[model samples]
Target: MAVRPPVSKSNVFLLMVTGEIESAEFPEYDGLYCNFSFFYGQDWTVLSNSSEGITQTSMRGSSPASNFVWNFPIDVTFKSTNPFGWPQIVVSVYGVNSLGRDEVRGYGSIHLPVTPGRHSLDIDMFVPEPASKLQKLVSWLIGPRPELVDPKFVARGEGREITRVSSQGFVRANVNIVMKDFSKQGYRNGTERFSNNSS
Candidate 1:
């Protein structure tokens, strides 16, 4: 009788983020760029080579919508103890200022699918609004807000262009990913950093 080798417990998955923003709320009209990152529980992996997230889809003209695809796909290997519990994809949009400072125009997050297959997702962008004195006072008295990014900025609709003045409307984008799941791979969790987009 021949003996069979045991399958390893870890799983590998490839992640791809498609870039698009139907509309973005900005105080001024200027060129725009986007950055993206993937977070698993507490641990995080950037989709870019620089400390900042991946730089992509630069809009030269004054426009709210951007449709560009990030050619690079990130490969991540982790323990698939609970495959259902996948991470979240966070996106940050920035506007390039004349002074060389980049201001955050919007932020958003989308849940990643755990099942191994190609999936398409629509992620809505959330733009921050300046708070009133009373709102800030009340929040301070109660306690610090939970999220680093304000929750009130979350857009209500998906793939719609926002044109409200007070609301400083938001936008949505599409992301397509082909997640290839592999078992018994040589790579292990914590063995090495996932990848550097620069390389």
Candidate 2:
């Protein structure tokens, strides 16, 4: 009889994400660009190099109510021993002003879908507002908009309550998620077991 090698158990699971930052609606803005990044827990390790990128500047369409189209691609893979900290994508948009400087227009974030399949997310974007009228006037004169020092702060709930922000616009994203060994790791949810077939 041939002896069988001992079976090895692996706890790691893979999360694959492929998507694009499709478009945005900034009614008053033109000549827009975007910056994107991921925020994940300590347990997660990125397996792909498409972690962060900047999109080319896009001008608003000629017609009224036309959105800025970037179609920026997103492809990333992550491996983790546990799902304690799922990943979230953070997006910051900027517009070229009369001074030709990039001024932050909006900030938004969305948690990656827990299930493995295609997902479309419309992230509501907001911009920090000046706390006082004097501050607002100064910013308007100086061409310095109220912007976050660290845009990733959008991903976290802490300390956000203290900041005053105004709704500016929204960004659309399309993402396809694939999971490996998720069920084998004893993590199963009603939605997690669904088929990958897009409806």
Candidate 3:
């Protein structure tokens, strides 16, 4: 048997970039990416490779182990671009099974507006664990101090903390939502704050 990661799991490959362009007028290329490990039967590490694009990146079952799902993710950053036309960004991923089979894929493409603004996407990095778990563990040992965004408020329950972030963001330390405990607390008097839905 061969060792492999499972599907139905998501690992954040890249930070949540505010914005990225599908294509640019000057074409500022970021780079290629990979999620699977390159080394096997030894201590694994941050495996990576440099390539022009996926058109040249290849995978084969003949290797000691094979990729079950060739699908990886790519993200783009928009430095500058023309004003007239929007360009399309294309991406694709495939996989092979033990029986030498390839998975059907969709020709992924994105048409980004030329106008400058913010954008975001869920990048995929095939680490063996969820991105959050990796962060908590590595950050502690590797001396990574999180940005520490101003938490509006903190409420803890059963080893879980609900933080109301400054940007009206609410993060549940636990991923479950349906069973989340909700409540209404009265302001002890003039401790009231007002907010509007208008951005």
Candidate with best TM-score = 2
Assess candidate 1 and give its TM-score to the true structure: 0.47
lDDT tens string, model 1, 1-199? 9889998644444444443333344444456666665545423343433322455544434444534334333343333333333566566666654555565656666676543334555565654432566755764465332223432233224323442223323434444443333223332333134422210
Candidate ranking under lDDT, highest first, comes to 2, 1, 3
Output the number of the lDDT-best candidate: 2
Model 2 C-alpha lDDT per residue in residues 1-199, reported as the tens digit of each score: 9999999998899899998999999999898999999999999999976899999999987987899999999999999998987999999999878888889999999999988779999999999999999999999998688889899999988999999999999999999988888877877744543642221
| True-structure RMSD, every candidate | 10.9, 2.7, 23.7
Alpha-carbon TM-score of each model against the true structure:
0.47, 0.92, 0.23
Q: Residue 89 lDDT in model 3?
A: 32
User: lDDT (CA) for every model shown?
Assistant: 0.45, 0.90, 0.24
Q: In candidate 1, list every pair of residues with a backbone clash.
A: none
165 Cα displacement, candidate 1 (Å) = 14
Please identify model 2 stretches exceeding 4 Å from their true place: 1-5, 191-199
How many clashes show up per model?
Answer: 0, 0, 3
What candidate 1 gets wrong by more than 4 Å, as runs, is 1-28, 42-52, 60-78, 98-100, 133-199
| Clash number for candidate 1 | 0
Find the number of clashing residue pairs for candidate 2.
0
1 against 3, candidate with superior TM-score: 1
Residue 184, candidate 1: Cα error in Å is 12
